[model samples]
Target: MRFALSEDQRMLQDSLAKALVDVSPLDRVRRFAADPADTAADVWQALAEFGLPGIVVPEAYGGLGLSMLEAALASEALGAAVAPVAFLGSVLAPLALVRAGSEAQRAEWLPKLASGEVLAAAAIGEPIAGARDGAGLVAKAGKLTGRALFVPGGLAAGLIVAADAKGGLHLVRGDAPGLTRAVMPTIDDTRRLAELTFADTPAEPLTSNDALAALRDAGWVILAADTLGASQAMLDKAVAYAKERRQFGRVIGSFQAVKHLCAEMAAELEPARALVWYAAYAFDHAPEEASLVAAHAKAHLSEIGRFIARTSTEVHGGMGITDLLGLHFWFKRIGQNRQLLGGPEKVREIAARVQGLIGA
Candidate 1:
């Protein structure tokens, strides 16, 4: 009858949060964001040392063999700190390999991926399925050609798990012939996006037909969890500021309006945390409901995340816009999460179709 994180899950979240705070403080994040050449290597290594890179990998391949719930927890931790690590790719690559890859491919890549000896990026956004504005990938004869946009962590990835037209997943080496990566400018530099162009680039395809669907579901859950964490961080900052900021000989926390804003944020965000946890739990334990719940989680959190970000910024007033507080990082992170994979409208449409309320 109880729905809550297990004691072990709580401990995992606490330990990882502490590690992130130590390795990726606001100052370090600012410096990393300012330098295009900076890859946040220290933070990435710290995460790897914490075994996040291998969280979901099967024990046979040296991973912790954890489930999607644990992965969601790790994502929450990352979003709370706005750490600039390539987590999406690291998590998804192993998943793709495990679900769709051949025995040879799994043996060759899983261990390296689990150990963080190689970094991977993901280009599995829905836009990759339908060529738009001259984007999207096409696979033929074990090679891929065309373009994929908004590839996260693509710039530094050694491997890329790309979804091609027709919903097939392929693994493309970062240095594959005729492949080029270009960074896309965005408000949130904490997690960089890239445009990948492949011209007759060699690729290895995952054999399973369901791999892409699994990836999509997992992606939705992870993005939702990330937004939850970022929103919580923003709310925490707003509350902390309200208690200390004084005006008219009284702390801002004494103001009814301020208390209402913080209370509203809490009311909206706390329920969303449950939604994310349920989505993640369903992904691992209730496979039949995973897609629907995942879509709901992602869409709902995107809307709630925006509310928290804006209201939190409003709480800080002028200081929110300034770089000194570094609040914009969390704000921008929420904005980006809102659009990643699928926005609210798109995800809701998918959910509707899943329930037979709309045509696919």
Candidate 2:
């Protein structure tokens, strides 16, 4: 049993990196800032063809049935390229349903999603759920009436929903007669989010504590991987600028201050990278502790990523702030990722609680 990426994984990463670079270039990300339809459709279509859309779906369901670690690695690559596809929303959410859905439901829906015939989304962070003193939502019976905000790729979802009702997960159609979706403005234009309202909409229920938690835990791990990738991009950008930018009589990169800062950023990044891999490793081996470890990974990477993005911009001077130099891409994503998965403080607090550092 080796604990390293196999030859196949490396090949997968290399192939995807080569193909997606052209579609998800940094310059194109800038242009898509205000365009709702500015998603990387060609890239997504290609990925579906590669069987990634069903990476975790079972063979009976038309998926590769790969491990969560594979999904995490793929997610990291997507983030590194700033690819504009919603693997989390499109695949992870449905995988959640597949894990917990009844046999009948799984037989009906999983194949559709695995083949990319129907896109889905998970709506966990509804307004009230994430707001101060927020209480989780419950979907009772067939009708759902509530507001789910900041739902990523919701507008593009064919089936969208994830509300806990009496200790069970609920699913809903995106265009259920009573559903209303409106795209919400976000700093990261590459990823689309929305405000979804379910006005007496229909829903299906899936009951399985083990499966539900497994799927959600997998999502947390993937997000951590995303943060690590984004942070690495920022680090790379800063290093390049330090090497090329001039100051005084020579390249500013030679200055002790710049070197020290870059070194510090590297130091910060290393721990987060370790945490992410460790968490993903835990996801496969230690299902019971995966949630806490995933939270830990997400917490560490998010803070470090934000720090790197900010400093990357600063090192580039005023030019970095301008769209021309494009440091804002990293900065905006850092801010977005900070809020994603509940941020550092939220996750740290949760982790501490899990460890009994504070009274539960």
Candidate 3:
């Protein structure tokens, strides 16, 4: 029942944060927004160099063979900077694949994913939510044909993981025939979202419809972990601003209202951290409940994380929105997370359904 970072986890977390600060600083995020090639290659290499891309994979597959808790720790550190690239898709996408793929499939695909030789982007969601029949979404047969919006780093991805009409996972080569994609601008400058279209694209089934139903739920856990890191960054920014920005007579942080707000942000962060870790633990120790915990974590963290981000805008006054300051970066990150996998209401309903609160 106890949740805390082990000694090695803490060290690795610090190392991951420091490494990103060195190679993927805030300035890099801005520049990358203008030029997509600025730091991705280095960042991608750094992740591989640090054994990051392989954390959740088994050791035999050329990975660190660590658990989701370890991967979540590393992910949280990257989230602090709103780091470019979809670490989850590149890392966790394969985990889901290995869990459901055939022995031949696992032997080949996992090692490539672990060593960073293959990068996969999860293609889900649509901007309009309708280019096809209204369904839960699915990937079927040996072909996947659909459009997905907001694919993270999708422009550079070499593989595309998608869901077809049956809600099964289909792994399609990035260069497959009848496939095309476009990068779209997003509120989060550090992240890249692409619009992807597939027309009878060749695909390899990663998992069946029933199995995908579960992995889809687990996606919320990874998203929640990222949200927690973003909330922490916003909280840090608000505190630093409160201390340095002078008021009528003294620093605003000295005032009771500002202090209370900061304290509340801190309190909210605890629950976010606990829930994320709980979700990670479920992924590691109790796969049965990972989906439920993922829904709970996403629902709770999304609600509070948005509150923190919104309050930070007010705390920083008008400067919060301006490029002169970087608060908008984290604010936008929160916004992205809110709608990335699903909104708070959708996840809460999932949580409710899991507990049988309402009949399906």
Residue pairs with backbone atoms closer than 3 Å in model 1 (clashes) = none
Candidate 3 TM-score versus the reference: 0.93
Residue-by-residue lDDT tens digits, candidate 2, 53-171: 88778887788877777777777777777777777875566566666777888887788889987778877653212542333454666677667777777887987756653345677
Ranking by TM-score: 1, 3, 2
- Candidate no. 2 TM-score: 0.92
Q: What tens-digit string does per-residue lDDT give for candidate 1 at 154-243?
A: 998988998887789898987899999899898887989999999999999889888888898898899899999999999999999999
Best by lDDT: 1
TM-score of each: 0.98, 0.92, 0.93
Off by over 4 Å in 3: 36-39, 126-141, 207-209
Clashing residue pairs, backbone N/CA/C < 3 A, model 2: none
Where does candidate 1 stray beyond 4 Å?
A: 127-131
Model 1, TM vs. native? 0.98
C-alpha local distance difference test of each model: 0.90, 0.74, 0.77
Lowest-sum lDDT 10-residue window in model 2: 126-135
Error of 3 at 278 (Å): 0.6
Clashes of 3: 7
Q: How do all the candidates rank in terms of lDDT, highest first?
A: 1, 3, 2
The residue-by-residue lDDT of candidate 3 on 43-108, one tens digit each, is: 788878888878877888888888778777877887888887688676547766777777887787
Tell me how candidate 1 scores on lDDT: 0.90
Model 3 local distance difference test score: 0.77
